[model samples]
Target: MIIVVDALNRHLFSDILAEMHALRARVFADRLGWEVTVKNGMEIDEFDALNPAHVICLDDDGDVVGCMRLLQTTGPHMLADVFYDILDGEPPLRSSRIWEATRFCVDTEKLKGRTTRNSISYVTSEVMIGAFEYARDAGVLDAVAVIDPVMNRVMQRSRNAPYDYLGTPKQMGKVKAMAALMDCSEERIAGIRDFAGINHDVFGSDDEVLSLFKENNGSAGNGSREITLESAYDFAPEPEAVRKPTRKDLREYCEAQVASAANDEEKVAALALKLELAEILRGDVQNRCDA
Candidate 1:
């Protein structure tokens, strides 16, 4: 399912937003080597402060598997502020009816190999559908996205190709970036729907969306299943606490971080943390045996 999170209701989806930012960190900063700011394992930029609407894709487990940030072009946006170089010296497009989409990414580590549902293809289409539809309903006439040639091809293959290009492609970091224009029309939405074989409404109700977070808060949440050094400190026990995390919990957290580390620095940090935790576990076991 998909959820459109805006500034008004963003408070309600804090957890989802966290996961989304983390996912962006993994994708852009870690995988793609984009020069993005990643703080505490979350990728955030100045545009994010503008309260742009986020179209998020949630898998059956209610995890934020995919997401995209949408900002109105009338104000400060990526195309205008950051990616103006892609405009080939032309002025950035500005209008109330046009929006800029960016930071489109998916959780490739989690949603891997599957052909449907949680697959990369599925979430990509789902995010696109949610983004375009949400913008269209809000009286947006078009959406401009900063994309690479690879993403452009993916958009073409998925029947959601941009109708036109605004400027020449320019090298940005590891890949070439260009401004692509896509209209928020029913025909384009229908084409994507047909290609993805998605017929039902993608938007989730407020009650339905909130219910998933309730489930997350009750359990250990995604924090337990996928742990990082940043999260390790966050989940640490209080000084006065009597109980500690189980051995299995510690092991899983360490192993997950080691496996999912985005870069060499992260991997080295995870390994060191894993070794430190392992030593503690060994000491606890030795004490129990001696007793």
Candidate 2:
């Protein structure tokens, strides 16, 4: 199958939208038996229209068989809203530094076993790389994702293990983990591509690909894995006094912000402000620690 990654645009928007709804219906409504609101067989929400997302297309006999949506941290995202209940506190949002990847669905009926690829692991990887490039071009620094442990394994393989365990892998229905991309490396990107089984020619040389990871990593070791739930608690600014934000708080904060934003600029600006607040809070908490 020839996998193509493209930003959703007017020309292909309707088709991709239909494809996404169909995939969601198959996976969520039909197969999983979850009650998902479908409009003319399309599963969509406010986020679909609010965030910049990419679609994965499988051109097998000139048809789009599989796809997923990616949301950057700068936008309203599942990590900050729907899945916030699983988190310890408000996740860092509105960072030119980080992005959230969300709403990943594939047309399982159309393409099976794509996730098991020894090289790519799943079709999501391509969308991920596409998202990474999209972020990089837009000057994004980090990528944050709440992933299943199995999918986490794929991410670990991609970055050559740049992250440490944030918290023990928490199960949300399935075994899910909260993960961050503190840094990305060439070796990591190559590994991810190799794992995804994507042609190296498309990504370019080890050095070129590595350059992309480096660019994304930002400020040298700034990209290196450092802050984790374990380490954060251990060397926090106020180890004894600080308390992690609860999932409820995070969710309310996100929902409130989303509801309040009157326009895209407002939403982006608000999220950026929140990210700044999160950084300040985290830093203040960290400064109190000995380490």
RMSD after CA superposition, every candidate: 19.5, 16.5
lDDT, candidate 1, equals 0.81
| Candidate 2 to truth, TM | 0.56
* TM, every model: 0.75, 0.56
The segments of candidate 2 whose C-alpha lies over 4 angstroms from its true place after superposition are 1-8, 33-35, 113-124, 154-171, 174-185, 200-291
lDDT of 1 by residue, 18-133 (tens): 77887888998888888877777787776776678999988887778899999987567778667778887766676667899999999998889878777899899999999999
Q: How many Å off is the CA of 89 in candidate 2?
A: 2.9
Error of 1 at 288 (Å): 78
Please tell me which predicted candidate would have the highest lDDT against the true structure: 1
Per-residue alpha-carbon lDDT of candidate 2 for residues 21-134, written as tens digits (9 for 90 to 100): 556656766775655555544555545554345544433222334455556654456565556555555344554456666556555555554334312235556555555555
- Which whole-number lDDT from 0 to 100 does residue 89 have in model 1? 72
